[model samples]
Target: MNRFALNHATTKFWDQREAVEACARIGAGIGLWREPVAAAGLAATAALVRDAGVAVTSLCRGGFFTGGDRAAIEDNRRAIEEAAVLGAPELVLVCGGLPDRDTGIDTARARVAEALAELAPYAGEAGVRLAIEPLHPMFASDRCVVSTLEQAVELAAPFPAETVGVVVDTYHVWWDPRVFDAIASAAGRISSFQVADWVTPLPAGVLTGRGQLGDGCVDFRRFKTAVDAAGYTGPIEVELFNDVLWSRPGPEVFAETVERFARHVA
Candidate 1:
């Protein structure tokens, strides 16, 4: 059986309390969002998940290098600290894109590398691995400068294995022509594998139209096969941010995610 998990963004309709309950009840792990963690109080959120015996797959987001400013870097560092406190194994980084008014992807990538160099040592000491999430090219303008697995791997070259890695999310990377080869190249360093489907007609430029599993273009079985072949033995987490799913009750969404995991991914 595939080990299914939930990214907290999918349950945006629920408060932290409900999110935890859903995960615990369904034997699912969680990928947490920074806002919910802050709102619930990091310590309290950590304790709640622990008390419910749920595993946290990854902490959703730490990087915003495009800001290329002191404040953004500090915020990223704090995210690492929060991940450590929660016992999260990986800190998923959606490295920011161009600074306000910029339009080049190349410059943004250079900034990401610089910021990664700064945080790697600190993240290593925190016992947390920085999982760089390569957002889809659609977000190249404002969300993440890193948009391909090859680029993501190259970006982690300067960091040690324990300090840095990459996350392979189907929603973000499914369209990459080199995805198969990249996964093979990633080998043991693919820190997290998040699953979600891609939808057309993006609501806005900021990446908000993620599709539910089996509801869109993603082929989870093939993707999971690739991850497994690459020796990634971690959980395949479901992470979606669709307005429709977000408007539904937490329990209903939880049930559908698990059903899809079994029907399609397994």
Candidate 2:
């Protein structure tokens, strides 16, 4: 079997506790979200993971510091603590978009760097690495300004390699021609590898349009090989945000993801 994982967002309506239990049954790891973890109560969820013997591959998110807001930073701090308690080694960072008043992508990206410099040490102390995830350029204005792997790696450069790293999420990056080169150069700084496909005729607003594996144009096998060659020896997380997938049962989605990984990614 492949080193596959189900990022909780892929099965948005699934009960977090049941997801953990299902992962345990199949010896697959899981990527969790802070909201669910908090809703279930951190201590209780931590105990659930421990009892189930399911690995917490990585935490969903812990970044949004583009606006230099103290609240965002503080929220990330708590996310780090939660990851540590749950035995997750890294907290994925979805650096936020431009502030309503701001218009420059450069300035927004700089804010991300400043935030990382300030938080990296704290994360190191808390035993969690920050994984900077760059979203597609289409989301530059309202979701994330960091639009490529190169940019994400650059933002992570100043910090200690272990304390700050980049997440190579294929869905946001498959269109980049130099993607493999960037992946090769990331080397040890690659903290996470997530996979999802891109389909055309995007859903309204496009946020939840991610395609299931093998159902779109993404070259999953190619991405898998590139990350492996880049020395990423971690779980390959499936994180589709498709509404169609969410309409089905979580167990069914999980099984489909596994089969798709075997056929298209392994």
For lDDT, the strongest prediction is: 2
Candidate 2 collision pairs? none
Count clashing pairs, candidate 1.
Answer: 0
lDDT of each: 0.86, 0.91
User: What's the C-alpha lDDT at position 114 in model 1?
Assistant: 89
| 1-266: candidate 1 lDDT, tens digit per residue | 33788888888767877888878887778889889899889999999999998888899888888877888889988999999999899999989877777547677778888899999989999999999989898788778878899889888877887789999999988988899999988887898998888778778644568988888888888899999999999888888888888888888888888888888787
Once fitted onto the true fold, the runs of candidate 2 whose alpha carbons sit more than 4 angstroms away are none
TM-score of each: 0.96, 0.98
Model 2 scores worst on lDDT over the 10 consecutive residues at 99-108
Best by TM-score: 2
